[model samples]
Target: MPRKRACDSCHEKKISCDGGSPRCDWCNHRNLDCTYHRASASSRKRPQPAEFSLQDEIEQRLERLESLLQGLRRTDRGDPSPPAEISDKLPSKSQPPSHGGIFYGSLYFAGCHLGDISSRNGIPIFSDEGRRWVQDRTGEAAALEGGQELSDIDLDFAQNKLSDLALLGGHNSAPPLPTKATAQRCLDIFRASTLQVVFPVVDLSTFQEIIDRAYEETTESTRAMVCVLSFVSFLSLLEPQKTAELLPDVEMYATKAQQLLLLTMAEPTIEGLQAALLLCLYLDFSGQLQAASMLHSLASRSLFMLGGHLKPKPPSGATPDDARLRHLRTLFWLCYFCDKHISLRTGQPHAIADDQCDLALCDDYTGLDFIDLKMDGPSLAQYLPKPLQPSDLGLTIIKSKVFSLLFTPSALKKSDTEILHTVRMLDEELERWRMSVPPSVRPSLSSVSDPADPSLQHEFGMLLIFVRFEYLYLLSAIHRACGRCQAWSVDGGVPNAVRSSLLLSVEASRSTLIYLKVASEMVHRESFWLVIFYPLWASVTLFCNIIYKPSARHAQSDVELVSAVPSLLKKLRARVPTPSEALHLQRLEAFIAELIHLANKAIYKHRPENPTAQDKE
Candidate 1:
């Protein structure tokens, strides 16, 4: 009798099947529905021995490759090999063994998490519980020393201000535009302020033309343009004394711009993209960082959809004087600038990747020749501030490189040696970039001792101050990797590499605070956002340093600097009109206060006379 054929299912699955009636033995064993097709004479031809051997070889090779891959995976996970005796045993049905590793649920960038430094190295005094214990002891010590109790203001503010600001959920209606005179006043203020210089997203003449046209006719494009203008006006009023009486109007304009931008979000245009970028700036300034970050992403995506990331090529036969294309390029660079800075500030990935676009500056920025237009008696250059230069974009490009090389996900995964090498290379590159800046606007590591040059102060002071703060901030960020990679000696001796990195990081933090302190007035007047993150970041670094080594020579001064944070934050809070600004400031003030208290307690315990006092407590 001819051999019975296998069922189709078993044959397709490449498994042995007994030719049973209605159902094969393999299908019956598995309780599967089985059907068999009638075998044709040609299909019944058996494979030659050589073919069978080849098929067996292929299967064996695949199995070996799979086993090798599994072994590699296990090695990557640091899993030890099982004993040969139990190698073929099935995994137990019982609960799997615990890996004994702690998993972190939240995102952490270099130097962002205090726990990373404190928890590692077994420093109990720097831990959260240790800080709480110190707080209790400090309260008792304060009571014994007749120290005044914390004021009711601080206590009440801490209790009430703990809630996060509501960044979303607002009225959807667009607020009415400001009166013509008020609008013009805002436009003038925006032009005069350093905001235009810093962002440089809009062309002054074009912006004026759009505003004039909006008053004449209300089209969709004009409406979006109005939104952009509203945001500029709102930012101009951030200086407390300049628009104290119109503080309420500041919110109105901000709301109007925000609502208008939302309306235009569904149909993104270049104008709408501009509005979104401006709104992002406003949100960041108001301490709505997450909202700002989301808006930034939206703007960045819109920019890509509009092909703003690529070099702008005018249409066929179009004149070389493509002002629109130039504007788009300007907007692209502004987005790039904001993307890098926001990523650093929030410890998040940047929206714009450097490799995706051209880094070269536009012809308008590189070309020095500008035909002076006579605006009545004043030239156009005198009438409106100059746009950003190649130097400005060059610094931004360097900043992009810093984020790419130092803080990126891949960078974070680099080995200790690789991280150290990359940090050194970036430091040298950053130093080179700094040296190339003109002396008039060059930033230094030391605090500014003399007043800025009156000639360049108005136009370039904000840029200079930002560069200084950013330099220190980047320095701290770069060297902080060393802290993560440093291995503690069994003998408790500090390694030279660790010492150098610690000093550099701490010095950068100190310089940031001192620079801000000296330039506080200018920073507050020109850009409130500049003061927001740098001071807090620096204060945290100082706090960590003091906690890590309370007996260090600068411990006392670090405490003093941390103590001064509340005052500085208060001054910043006074400049912004948002109620949430006060709440945000209060929370930071509380944190700084706690840090100062803990730092002071740690220092007291470390004193020679009080060496045994900590033990007694």
Candidate 2:
């Protein structure tokens, strides 16, 4: 006779099965119900087998009844009631097979039918019903034969049920909210340590007012603000080894804050939107990109619905009031900044485009100067950077506009000449922006001499470093766009024009590397919130140039710039203690290591270790 076939599960998985009776080894190993189809003479075109022995016949009948009971218990629990009365369908042990021992075959057929019915009704074989079904069937099976099989069935049922029950309970429940005094402490920590650097959109006094008001009423918006405050406190705890002890409380507050955020997502308001953006920043810092993307999109939609992108209309007859406009304008620019930053990282189109937005630029806020107002009276000089200065806001808009101009669908169709022209216009405008930088904010060449030392010579704050850094990045972006399109020229290899464009890119990348070298050493460093991408990608571009244009005039400088990146990143990584920062640094370090190996093999093989030649052309 032909051997028995594998079980359905094994066949589906395309694996070999031992083809054991009642249960195959493959499914058994995985705690899955091993089922085998009884071969029929007609289907296989084979001769019928001789009659089974009396003992074999009795075992087969018991197995069939057990399978039937298992099927009944597999029905969907949501079916309003438990499985039908299966015990009534089983035959008694005292009764022997009637009709020449055909009873075993009949039981097997009934089991197959019940299993198919239960599966079609959307029931899982391993659910609660299956557990109860096994219990009932095992008792009945035990009466017929008490031995190894009965004990095995009972053991498997107990083990599986315990595992299932463990999954149903929330064993790792969250900690309770911080006490009022604890919350005040967390808030104080945030205000004293983080608010200035983080540039929280919520004003200090306004935030304190919200915290006080939050205790009075449990509004969704207020709760969201509380969560935001908690996250700010959490960020503050990320640095300084001494603060490590307080991290657990920070984590608890952060979790509670997220739970409250989810509750307020249904009915979003300006306060809620602000809170959501802050949460997005926190998530981005934590390397939770998927969650951050969702909140970023949410904040974008809420801002648009509130007409944040449009210029505010003045009262019909009243004096043109622009006091509150300053705050609203600040909110709008922050949203735009976030949209552009996320868009570049994700390669997704931004929600708000240059054409659709009519809001005033950050540069326009200079005359009004309402943003300079401090929490304690009019101490404008202290808040000079004013969370985000007019210049910084202008630079952010410039980056946003550049991204729009480069990534739009139609950009690919433009000719190389058109792209070059666009680059020229942007470069000229960028030059003007550089000239307009306040004398106090610009760093002297001497400031960057000792790459390891932080810059203390300048009175300017983080805003200056941010603007300078972004300017270099934008120049790199423009040239990168120009160089990418020059590939379609259909000319000789590495044409001078293409080489020149690529050279501009190398120079821009060099500046970016130098800025990062010094800026990474600043007292209040730029947040690693997507700001890290500029140096990371700029290094990649420089590496590609060293390999592809080894003969270019600036080849030595390019290699030097690329070689310095790993050390620069290490210094920067030492400043931030977050896991996300560490992960990014590890990957970047690996990338630079590979690039160095490749550079040694390709360019350094023929060149001297210390070449005196400089790129004069």
Candidate 1 overall Cα lDDT vs. reference? 0.56
How well is each residue in 519-575 modelled by candidate 1, as lDDT tens digits? 766664435654567887787678766655566678898899878877775664444
lDDT per residue for candidate 2 within 1-617, as digits (tens), equals 34445565554332345778667775565555665453444466643312222233223423433443344235422232212332222222123322121111011111111110010111111222222222222211111110011134434644654564344333223324444554565566655543433344555555555666555534433454455554444454344343455444454455455555655556655566667777776666554454577777887787777777787765455432353454555667777777776665554567777788884654434411232212223233345444543236666667776766664545533444455455656666665665565443443222334544332333333445655566667766765665434222121122334344445555566777777766676634325545566676566567555544444455677667778877776555434444433443554466566655555444543243424211111
TM-score of 1: 0.67
| Native-to-model Cα distance after best TM-score fit, residue 613 in candidate 2, in Å | 20
Q: lDDT of all the models against the reference?
A: 0.56, 0.49
TM per candidate comes to 0.67, 0.61
Cα lDDT for residue 372, model 2?
21
lDDT for 160 (candidate 1): 43
Candidate 1, superposed: residue stretches over 4 Å from native: 1-113, 116-175, 216-222, 225-229, 238-248, 313-321, 363-386, 389-391, 447-459, 489-494, 613-617
The residue-level lDDT of candidate 1 at 159 comes to 51
Off by over 4 Å in 2: 1-175, 185-198, 217-247, 314-326, 362-364, 367-386, 389-391, 442-460, 486-488, 492-498, 523-526, 551-557, 574-583, 605-617
Q: Local error of candidate 2 at 92, Å?
A: 75
